[model samples]
Target: MVTMTVSHKRKDALKDVWDAVSSGWGSVTSGGVWSNAETEQEFEARLQRWENSGLAHEEAKRLGQKPPRAPRGWHKRQYPEIKRGDKAKYGVIGWARAVEVTRGANGWHVHIHAVLVLEGRQQAHERAYALGRSMHVRWNKGIAKRGFTSSKEHGLRVDVSEGAERQLAEYLAKAGEPEKAVRNSVEKAGKALAREATLGQHKIAKRGGRTPFQI
Candidate 1:
């Protein structure tokens, strides 16, 4: 676990870096609930039927390959390619990160945390809703009464504000399993900024100048 005592300066630096890296992107969280089966086996059977269907086999044949291994759940089967396509639609710019997807006898759920560079804040929600609808996943527009909010089917929850980067970053960092690219970008930027400040101080000291950071 990488822990740091966040001073005011450090916080400001992180905010700056996050903003710089994510300026044009709108933060989006989209997901769906597949089913509410009484047992896992019932859900698996449905998935198996879908996989063995002629349509699935035709899709594999169209790609000139065998059917891919079955995903453990809906999120695993669907979200990854959708995420990549979303990013690629913007010429492979911006970030697509996911938190852990979980399943239970009651239902299965996942949240895809994304920074949409191609779509501005003005268009993010519309685009997100369109995409969510196309995927046939339940998009929840408001909070659920209990349990995981993403498990509901209202609409896609999209937000793009001044503080959005930090909010999305924090979500991705939950459970110590952050999206690799965003986590590395934030960490690298912060480190580079600190190192530059330190080097600047060292240069001033070599010239017998007072260190500005000293109070």
Candidate 2:
């Protein structure tokens, strides 16, 4: 019974995607997601490139010369390792994910928030840990292919909770109503269950920086 607000125009389309992901699920054992962070050197190099591009464009305009075209298809050039991981045999029964991006002192950050439904209920913690480790390894390899690297410790996070499934169901059911009263209630409850399945992206940022929402 997950509920979310939608425009009158896009409600039907959103529902179709939701139905496909959440149709058949008995229980949720663990919840997890993946993210990669850049090194300081990588950040500086990218920033320098951006600044240089801006300067070059300005110079060309002043001289009445044709401005250089910015690099194109960079995202396309980077191999999408996550897509391959999604197709791997990971004992995943059903899953849903949203790709998110934000910028901070560390530069642009891209990550995935996902809810994975597993096949069975026995030894849930052990299973979740194993899965998390495996995911971390796979993620590292994938990011390397794209010329990025993340810490082994902070790359992937998986949490196991006995009451995760019920809390998740409640959170999803209340998260997307347009009414002011309903939205307030959902926020209160969502913060209480943020570590479980809530999709709000207000987590505190590392390195003494504020998250995009905070800024």
Candidate 3:
């Protein structure tokens, strides 16, 4: 059973992961990867699972016991923790951005706009393909028979460059806007852990592709 809670420590852990990804150190690139779902059915199903997991965890906590064991494949929606010991797989940082809306003609529409920073462009593409396949294989049925399709795979849409820093900062800012004190605490904790760059403060070259010190 995994007990997931929103705490200062957890927030800091997330900040550290975000800082590593935003730095783009060692040949990093960024892009949006769309999941391979011909219809939103598969994505919706996963969301239902996520919601149910949250409810179960809350219920268990209320009973003052260890949280119930999460269902298989439940980690897909949680924050991707970058363990210091796993340098190889931890090279990527990512998040899923999804929103649901009701359209007059289409009813409910769910769109997934996941973003990732990878070691390289080639790696970015390869990783996106793998992510799409994993999501399909994990939650969807008959993936072996129908196989995978580009339409259902993540689309390569953006190449994050120097300007990505600003975007990353914006993302972090928005993420913790609800609580300034907690956000500051997380930043401090993250910087202490990373010991490289402070959270949300690194000055990458600006929008013109030149650092402030550049002439």
Candidate 4:
């Protein structure tokens, strides 16, 4: 199980990751490509498992249809650590850059939908892919294949491109607001979905697109 409490060293390390992502990187960030999924039904099944096991719906949403699942990526809530890494890395490497680490859950495997952008799409992806591999190696404390998409039947997904950062931020802001104030906002979003919800559109609202539902 993941530790809910942070030790001094852990806190410091987290700060380091935060610093890497937040530095004066750039307007465009490089994207990391990693995906894992089985089927739509399977995805929902994973979401249900998370909810049943106490994970928030926000986390489940991240586990949308995808492939190379995410680490510590359980359900709807988006993990800031993933995006933070991107923000820290590419923020300095390119012109206009941002990272979007989306979530997805399924029996197949849950992974992040990461994206990075820079002056050019081509170079941004190349750099982002290499960096992702390096980070995975660093974080996991081992060396692994580093590239834009996974190889050996794992590269089928892992979306990337511009606006991914903003898009992900907006998504998290709506679904997984942290404090009570923000969480209340996300709850309101739930109510909004109950109201404006369309057929097969019962998924959570767009992060920034919808206002928090009122009581």
Best lDDT among the predictions, by candidate number? 2
For every model shown, the clashing-pair count is 5, 2, 2, 37
Reference-based TM-score of each model: 0.22, 0.40, 0.25, 0.21
Identify the runs in model 3 with alpha carbons over 4 angstroms from their true place. Answer: 1-90, 139-215
Candidate 4 lDDT, 13-40, residue by residue in tens: 3333333333312111223322222455
lDDT of each: 0.36, 0.46, 0.36, 0.33
Candidate 1 local lDDT, 35-124, one digit each (tens): 112345655665567556645656786899986654444433542122233333323234434222222222222223333343455455
lDDT of 1 at 176: 62
TM-score of 2: 0.40
Candidate 1's displacement at residue 215, Å, is 46
Model 4 gets an lDDT of 0.33
TM-score between model 3 and native? 0.25
Badly placed stretches (over 4 Å) of model 1 are 1-92, 101-111, 119-122, 135-156, 162-215
The digit string of per-residue lDDT tens for model 2 on 101-159 reads 44455444445455566666677567667766665555554444434445644556665
Task: Arrange candidates, best TM-score first.
Answer: 2, 3, 1, 4
For residue 114, what is the lDDT in candidate 1? Answer: 38
Worst 10 residues of 4 by lDDT: 1-10
The runs of at least 3 residues in candidate 2 whose Cα sits more than 4 Å from the true structure, single-residue gaps closed, are 1-90, 164-198, 201-215
